[model samples]
Target: MSTTTPPTHPQRAGLHRILIVGGGAGGLELATRLANTVGRRGLSEVTLVDRYPTHFWKPLLHEAASGHRDPASHHIEYAALARRHGFHFVQGELEALDRSECLATVGPILDLNGNDVLPRRLLRYDSLVLAVGSVTNFFNVPGAERYALPLENVKHAEEFRQKLLTACIRANHLREAGAALPEPTVNINVIGAGATGVELSAALRNAINLLSTYRLNSLEPERDVRVRLIEGGPRILPALDQRVSAQTHARLAGLHVDVLTATPVSEVRADSIVTVTGTELASDITVWAAGVAGPPLLKALDGVELNRQGQVLVDKTLQTLSDPRIFAFGDCAACPSSIVGVFLPPRAQVAHQQAVYLSQSFLRRLTGKRVDRFTFRDAGTVVSLGRAGALYQGDFGLGLRSLIVGGRAASGLYAFVYRRHLFALAGLTRMAIETVSQWLRARIRPSIKLH
Candidate 1:
């Protein structure tokens, strides 16, 4: 394997340097696990590198975009996590990779004014893990990248929320002054009926309702606010069970959300979206959640085998085919499934399971023990539908084929998924404290963010 000293922080002798790129759910969890175990025992040197200083669960990006959740209160500081756990944190974007030299170059950090803040640096690793995750794919649609907003990161989510607020306020002013408005109402078009699209559509409806209730805007939630969820597929949540999809569809309908299926968005204009069937839909704000592709850096990496979707191709052990020393998981890796012939689905649960597997694999490797192939356990799926509740479709390990539930029970199960993630990152005590804190905050603060 290629070997080199880190240009900035030289690796000490004997310690196996484990450098993980990306601080997403999988990378962060793996780093924490290794830090608490092998890292704490001085068996390996673990470091996590990410572009952002904080991490908020990607599943909650919809809530952030709809202003239903305050990101500041929920985000975990990377530095803080590193300090609490036994790992190092590096904040920078991955720029280039030199597989032969075993060096990964991080681009220079710049300020908002384009001034250089930190020079480019090289990081060397005995083993490298790429969990950089995926970004929105516009499918070569004309004007899509420029006109539609993508909820991929915190900045994007915040920007979408601000834009939504601005649109609502502007619409409210036009109505109040009785001016000839461009449209009689605010139209929001969400492309994609996947989990993200469906959840965001529901959250937006609830947000609009709350805003109208507080008299924050002059637009009526039931009349002047129109949310249309357009999907190219035959039905919403195509990856999920049909029962869950139907239940979620019903919940969205109850919330006054327009569900349009089998209609593909051909082009996204600044003020409207055109379907493949030559139909134009009015839109004040458009959100793109149709599909995801791996980060651009993955395709640029030399020698790394990638799938058609640009995801790094890995074996069941999550090791890259080109280099066993390099690994990838999460949404960035296309790991083959042992059960089905297809690759594993890109879901938070899949990443969580991989993280757990990798952590143990590292331990076994360090001890010169046999590392078993990774096996994915089918734990079912849950789709949240805002205040209308959620839909749960999973076997729950009862050896049953499937069990479907909705309403409050499903909502509780949906929450448990996130809570379980929290339990993994933080222990029971911290998770409890966070749960109580959020509950108390909900009691006092506004249900939605106004600013």
Candidate 2:
């Protein structure tokens, strides 16, 4: 490890550096769009600063963790994207913000191969946007941080994929070797019934099916591989409309995933989750896909107004409640949503929509024109339950009541959501490249990693 002094990008005396701290869906779009205009126009410069050098869509992280998808086949290199979009990409964590001095210090960058890439840096900005996303909230449960894995980013998802496949392989090995491992069921307890949890429970089951077909025929029956989707809410998909939630419930049940609602986990142990009902959920793999909370650094940012969950509070204009120069959006920021009568739920669609709005708004500011407040159009919701099927609710245009479709059609639509995003980011040509690459990977790679 190497530690150096502070490094700050020099800002022109009058021009503002449009620094964006997070490179998630919203932040990346905002920075790229702004760079295309203000950065190239020389009216302002756009710099996207992220903890990671590459950005993978957060929604697909679940699929990656379940081995249903691969990260290498679907990641955007931040440096390359910045260059392509006319911005600078900086890799560092958000350490602290000196709002008084208009300066923020970013945490050091370290390479994966044991070398210091860059040290803490102080970046001064005239206008700053914090698109930092949220993290899995364990809610202070005992052994949760110690044992349960969280699916936060590409790195976290990639690591959890190994844990999942390892559990499957170890259970099969112990059975064949005639040694009973502690929890012989290969049980997996998935906390939270939100989109990620609901989707992953189904994906894990589907992966086991593929594993048996191509690699581990000995583990013939997947019912033996127990998957319990535990949720604290009254039902899964609590954020979506009630009808959509009901549809998702039936589809998950058809997949034979144990859907446990109204069941809150009290503690996560070495190989199980203790429920409020006093029953121990025997799980060799414990995944916390539960609720989300903002990062700790957001709370520490020099008196910025934040909600109880620690997300930055922004008005309709996407500017923070307290700060004038700082704008916010995405999982880390609470922007007003007319449909919910409160802050909009942090969905990738909402973030992407807000980025489009903010980019135009910021451009207007650069040209000394008036900016408009953002208005989110609720485009309905869709959730896929692996091979079992999908649940979708949304309007199809023409002011008609949005139709909700399920089973195969919903599954296809559910998948199209991510595809639509890639099309926007990489266009048709790059998407074709990604498609061909994953198909080849699927052929050569094991149906499952088998640990």
Every candidate's CA RMSD: 2.8, 2.7
Pairs that clash in candidate 2: 395-402
Quantify how close model 2 is to the true structure by its C-alpha RMSD in Å: 2.7
TM-score for candidate 1, please give it.
Answer: 0.96
lDDT of 2 at 447: 50
On residues 232-341, what C-alpha lDDT tens digit does candidate 1 reach at each position? 99999998878788888888999999999999989999899999999999988999999998899887788999988899999988999999999999999999985565
Backbone clash count, each prediction separately: 0, 1
Regions of candidate 1 where Cα sits further than 4 Å from its true position: 1-6, 180-184, 339-341, 395-401
TM-scores, all models, native as reference: 0.96, 0.92
List per-prediction Cα lDDT, in the order shown: 0.88, 0.82
The lDDT of model 1 is 0.88
